[model samples]
Target: MLPLFHNLLLQLDSASGILRITLNRPSKLNALNAATIEEIRQAMQYALDAQAVRGILLTGSGDKAFVAGADIAELAELNEIVGRRMAEKGQEVFCLIEESSKPVIAAVNGFALGGGCELAMACHLRVASENARFGQPEANLGLIPGYGGTQRLAQLIGKGKALELLMTTDQVKADEALRLGLVNHVVPAAELLPFCEQLLGKILSKAPLAIGMIIDCVNAAYDQERHGYQTEANLFGRCCGSADFREGTQAFLEKRPAAFTGE
Candidate 1:
């Protein structure tokens, strides 16, 4: 494990089965630089393999900008090949996050635009502060979202709304985001952490394997023509057949809240 550092803005912590990854550049509003991206990817992979971690939380430092955007300086000099590589790498990392076994939640405190919004959207679900604003502003920068933004945005909101957001480069407020189903919950900045913890707690209280299956099913639900639904049904049935499911059912019948072992 790496020791925490001041300049090294990415903060990683675990408590009560929740491992948090905070983009630590408050001075710069937690912008995703290449270094930051590498660190984030590393932290996520660590949490993915760490048995002690069952749920993950991702947020930004300070009260503004979960991630303002990607570090533009790093991309300013990139050629076509380099740009393509960066996009591919970002997509891979973002996909890994979306498909992580441990459910990851994004706590958006402020302006989550461009890559910032993309990062939040990559999480299993988003919980935003009342002041948080979200957008995919790459179009305005003469660049498209390099992460999974283009695909995932449409999956989260509808295609029409996603296109509107992308084309207009307009930031959507928390209420609008909630209405669009972009965020699960919206609370004041003072309560952002607690709100995220509450949602994470709800997820942690369930069977771990079941949570994983549920995430898989929901992500699949976006593709109506694909075998996603069938796959989800099959996985759901398999979970129902697990020992954890049996114990959970028995516990329910015995008038007790089930303690799922996630077997």
Candidate 2:
């Protein structure tokens, strides 16, 4: 069972083992406020802990946005010390999503600007609606992306282009975002969630442990303290010790579908 949230709507599809977490403040274009962020963190933890949840699909309640940005009203009140803490808090929650063992895909239904774009980038994959617009426009506020956007944006696209977007505050349309390698797929607005579900359905069918280890290895590639190759080797050895690995090999030899228990 999923916990109730003040700012989110959690629906666990038991048949598909996918948790759908919707940011529920449609009146605010699903903007992230401190309450919303904290609730998201809680919801993410629930998804992470639930054995029935194989993956997560994150989106907003309304058609206008997945998350337009952080709540500017709340942002305006931040002092220097509070601003730093606020950034750290947001980053901490976002990193939880980034480093999850279970796959999380952002279904970008519309504008994903500022912190919204950061949240999308933190996801394992992003599927944007044709109407979706992505940008890091914090510079307009005399600020910068505090939720790992500066780093992840550069990593997702390129440092040069990232710098251009950050400086110019240009919003990349869905098609342009795809070309920039920011979003994995650009489908019609109506098909955004369905497409993400279809994509996750395919991934969830794979060996769960291996899927998680792959996430770890890929993330390790960007971790300065971790050797990606060594992480892969270690995880490979770990996978070799699992029942799923044994079943996978045996099923491959027998020409049958393998049933992975995530063991």
Candidate 3:
């Protein structure tokens, strides 16, 4: 069952274990206001706690934008202290999405700028529509990416390219984003969510625990202090002790499909 969220729509496909979240403020081009961000955080937490949720497909309502950017009016009211707090809050929320146990895929159907771009970067995978546009246009507003965009964009693409995009406020098309490794797939606008669901469905069929461990290890690779190899080794050892590992190996020998309980 889908729970009601003030600024978002949540729908869970129990059979597929895929949760679809739509950013609902289409009139504003689905801009990320504080309320919307908080609602998203709560919704993500709800997804995490729901046992039936195996994967998430995040997108926005309407055809125009995934999220154009942050709500400019709200942004205009920030003082230095308030601005710092807002940035920290946004970082924390996006961090949760990045660190989610279940894979979260961004189905970027249209304009994804500033926070919108950062939001997509936070997802484990991103699928964009052929007409999708991505940019960190905060430079034009006399600001910069405040929600982990500076770091995540560079991580997804390259530091040099990320800097150029940030400074120039240049928008990249879906094809260029794919070429730069910013998005995984580029599909027709109508197929965006379906493509993400199809890809996530395949991933959700695997051992859920192992999938979570993979996310953790991959994230560790980006942390300068944490040795990714060590994290992988540790997670590997843990997996060795899981029932899913035993079942997986046994099923391979038996030539049957393995059933993982996420234990």
lDDT of 2 by residue, 1-263 (tens): 47998889999899999999999999999999999989989999998998899999999888889999999999999999999999999999998999999999999999999989999999999999999999989999999999999999999999999999999999999999999999999999888888999999999999999999999999999999999999999999999999999999999999999999999
Which ten contiguous residues of candidate 3 have the minimum total lDDT?
1-10
- For residues 1-263, write the lDDT of model 1, one tens digit per residue: 63354423333445667877788888888888777777778888778887777788898888878899987788788889999998888888887898887899998989898889988988988999999999988887689898988898998898999999989998899999999999999998999888888888888998888888887887777656557879788998999899889988899899999988878
- Model 1: how large is the Cα RMSD against the reference? 2.2
Q: What is the TM-score of each candidate against the true structure?
A: 0.92, 0.99, 0.98
| Clashing pairs for predicted structure model 3, backbone only | none
Q: Write candidate 3's Cα lDDT for 1-263 as tens digits.
A: 57898789999898998999999998899999899889889999999999988899999999999999999999999899999999999999999999999999999989999999999999999999998999999989899999999999999999999999999999999999999999999999988887899999999999999999999999999989899999999999999999999999999999999999987
Off by over 4 Å in 1: 1-15, 222-226
- Per-candidate Cα lDDT values, in order, are 0.84, 0.94, 0.94
Assess candidate 2 and give its TM-score to the true structure. 0.99
Off by over 4 Å in 3: none
Query: What global local distance difference test value does model 3 have?
Result: 0.94
Error of 2 at 117 (Å): 0.3
